[model samples]
Target: MMLPTRLQGSLNNELNDGETILWLDQPIASRMARGAWPIVLFGIFWSTFCAGWMFFTINMAMKTPADQAGLFAWLFPAFGLPFCIIGLGMLTSPIWVRRLALRTVYVLTDQRAMIISRSFGKTHVRNYTPEKLNDINRSLNDDGSGDLIFEKVISSHTHTHRNTHSLGHGGHRAGGGRSSRTRTSTTTYGFKCIKQAKQVHELIDGMVLASKPVAEQD
Candidate 1:
């Protein structure tokens, strides 16, 4: 199939001598924008809280004499800094997603599916043949754009722990720790936020069927 001129050069570089492009498209920006709400809310909450804490810690550090501040006083602002940065990232994740949609491209050929993404000044290309795909499924959006999932997507979650210990001079110290744990995963790989999803699914199904042996088809 004919590809957009902008994508032709990149895809041509990846194609083998005889590989043919069956489909090529980019993900819909609105769909990504819709998917970004949860992240935006989380970012807002995280950034707001972390920024407040960071300001408070710095204020406390300034109020106390350097000699009397102790190691914990200095550590407080240091610890808060990373959290503040992380929160800022979370807050801006939606904009990043939109930018990513602009830089990402998807393609399906008779031999395989390909995803080309550029982020942080780096380009990543992922390829999947029919054999490499499993449990292909579709999720449709209200706008008729949808995602096709081919592989499982696992989400990582972090658990935090707070410990309070009594120090020698009628004083108590508080410390926090965090660990990551994974839960059940959902499907991840495949075309994301494309139009006419049902047609695309059927086309892919036909391709997969045609690739199987004649005996398997029966």
Candidate 2:
């Protein structure tokens, strides 16, 4: 879908039509943003149940024929601990997944595409405008992991650099030194465990690079 006109430059200057707002997959958003706590709670409960069951089973086994078997008894507890730990960890995977989902935020605007990460407030806001956009590149690994890395189109001016740094890092050193680091004008966007991520990356990268004038094309 075409993005909103507000995001495009110059009211008179025609720009490629893309959707104004492309929200991340709603299923992803629902689980991460709205249903995270409940899911986490469910996971905790389930994990606890399995852990308890495993512990009980181990004790019972030790008390049963295994213990009477003598030499094999010590091996039971030794083997049980690792299995318990692994099961417990498996149960907690949802929490980690939830946190990852929570950290993800995606927005596309007229002037830029913004990603506001999950923190108390906007922790990471990446803006990709035409000027700062150096190059839009997409790469996919054999396993289907893909990324769209927006290269900084142009170096940040003194005032823009200073202002961005101030807001981004509380005025501390950011992006290495302002002089040495050419600030990225884009965000790192990827889909975890999602199929066809490379196609999506390529589409966005094409739109980004297409914005340049013919003479500017490399």
Candidate 3:
């Protein structure tokens, strides 16, 4: 299938001289959004509960006298602010995921596969060679839509930050505490939420097997 004009324009510069496009498509946005339902449901409950708790704290603070309220009144409501913000973000996860899908395009070529994404005023193109596509995994849905998994990349992320403390009695002493967190995430690359996934997966699988050296194939 021909790609959208915008996608074609973005992809033209990356193609080899004679590369042939076997399949091209954008993921189904609505289909992708379906996966976020669990997050949305949890977010709804979380946001409701946090908002209610924050409001209750405010009510209590208002009813209490200033002398009794002290710093607890101010601290109580502020503590819930971040959770409320986080809950709001989760509530809109589906909408954000769907928007992300709309800006993504997937392509299968005679020699490689590509996942193109447009975000933050930039076009990013990812290409997977036959070597990386050797072990293709596929899952098809009842409606003829599915995902082709070509690469499983395990990445490690690290975040480092420092903590500061205050000293007593007009003497200032400074000490630094460092904290680091390491996380591993497996990122799957492929054509996701596309129609006729079985056929597409088979086509790519055959090409992958054929691309191997004669010794390996035998």
* Global lDDT scores for all candidate models: 0.78, 0.49, 0.86
Encode model 2's per-residue lDDT on 1-218: one tens digit a residue.
23223322221132247635433321153333343455546657766766676677667666787537575555555555665566555556566656655455444334455544444432444556755544545556576644445553444533333323333456555443333334435434433333345665554555566777888779
Largest lDDT belongs to which candidate?
Answer: 3
The best-first sequence of candidates by TM-score reads 1, 3, 2
Candidate 3 C-alpha error for residue 202, in Å: 2.2
Q: Model 3 misses residue 93 by how many Å?
A: 1.6
User: Least accurate stretch of 10 residues (summed lDDT) in model 3?
Assistant: 1-10
Q: What TM-score, to 2 decimals, does candidate 1 have?
A: 0.76
lDDT (tens digit, per residue) of candidate 1 on 17-99:
88887888888876786788898798888888888888898899889997899988878788877887888787777788888
- The per-prediction tally of clashing pairs is 0, 13, 0
TM values, all candidates: 0.76, 0.34, 0.75
- Badly placed stretches (over 4 Å) of model 3 are 1-6, 67-76, 154-185, 209-218
* Candidate 1 local lDDT, residue 117: 77
- Please identify model 2 stretches exceeding 4 Å from their true place: 1-19, 22-97, 108-110, 121-123, 131-145, 151-195, 214-218
**Candidate with best TM-score:** 1
